[model samples]
Target: MKGIRFWAFWPVAYQPSSLQASQPPSLFGLIGRRMTKGQRRKLNRIYFMKYCSNCGQPVIHRTPPGDDRPRFCCESCGMVHYLNPKLVVGCIPEMEDRILLCRRAIEPGYGKWTLPAGYLENGESVAAGAKRETLEEARAKVEILTPYALYNICHVNQIYLMFRARLKDKRFGAGAESLEVKLFGENDIPWEEIAFRVIHATLLKYYDDRRLGRFSFHMENISPPNPNPPKTDN
Candidate 1:
């Protein structure tokens, strides 16, 4: 079950660029380059499957007769396992001149602030998943106004769909996944403590739209963060 959760919710099947000769460049590996040293090591440590889930037999990592790329293939049951990217759905919950954020209780960003978001469940609509995540993470109810942004995070092999939402009421508290939930005005936002780059990008665009007195849907492709960012003389 833990393996299944990791496979579904976290990044996987990441092969570094050095190994891209035989196969295509791994978009998942790009995430490792953007992470801190410790975080990069953690992502690098997750290995591919050794056994097949279908028949509980050893699986071989090789390209089958027709497939272009390699996959986990089961000889005993003839099952082929494929790795796919995940969709992360969330909302920017807005009230009176403020937006809601939650302090994470889970790793990868434990104790840091983030918007309510999680993996989109199978068979669920993106808008419904965003609302459900808001309720689950911040204990807040919101009406999704419209999709504010769509991010293609190639590094993590994930798609982030963020919606503009209006808080139904002021009543909200921390949920099981959050240590605390609170509202923040533009000036009060903790820029350095944002949990993920994709979320940070969405927030930046949101505030930009606000300043222009209009909200527009946006789509962006994210690249790996620069490790050696230019130092500014302060």
Candidate 2:
């Protein structure tokens, strides 16, 4: 389990980039240009399987007979494991002049403000997942309008899908994963204390679009902080 009830609802396999193979940590490293040893270790523990799902045999990390890349393989049962990126779904829930937000009661940014969002469930639609996260974290009901932002955070092997929505009503409270639930006007937002870069980026765009009187889809690759980068998706 991706504990703490934060954004990381599920564990994902971490694959080191071949391009980042042996370079020293540099400015580009902050942007996922390279995978550090710590990064490799963090992912391996969560994603590397020890036992074959097909059988009760221990698995080995190796390339298959004809495969070029390394994989988790079971010699006894001939099972192979492949990993992929994860999808994080959430929404920007808005009322008349404010946006609904949750102060996380979980780690990976405990007690900080954030949009209502979480991991996309295996079978849930993207918009449905966003709505679910909104209701789950803020106890706010919302009707999703349109996708507002998409972030390709390659550094973390995760993608973010954020939607713009209209809050059903003003009635809301903190859910299990939040310390407090509140509505924030753009000027009142906790810019310095916001949880993640992607959240900050999304909010910035939302406010900008509002001023422009036109909302358009936004896509960007987020870069990690150069120093003391905060944990993102657990």
Q: How do all models score by TM-score?
A: 0.79, 0.77
Q: For model 1, how does the per-residue alpha-carbon lDDT over 41-154 read when each residue is reduced to its tens digit?
A: 444443356678999887665677777876767888999898788899999999979999999999989999999999999989999999999999999999999999999987
Clashes of 2: 0
Top candidate when judged by lDDT against the true structure:
1
lDDT computed for candidate 2: 0.80
In candidate 2, what are the lDDT values of residues 1-234, reduced to their tens digit? 423222211222223332223333442233333445555444444445767788978766556767676677677878887767889999998899899889999999998999999999988999999999998998989999998899998767899999999999988999999999999999999999899989999999999999999999999999755756577895
lDDT of 1 at 121: 97
- Give stretches of model 1 more than 4 Å off: 1-21, 24-47, 232-234
Model 1: how far is 201 from its true place, Å? 0.6
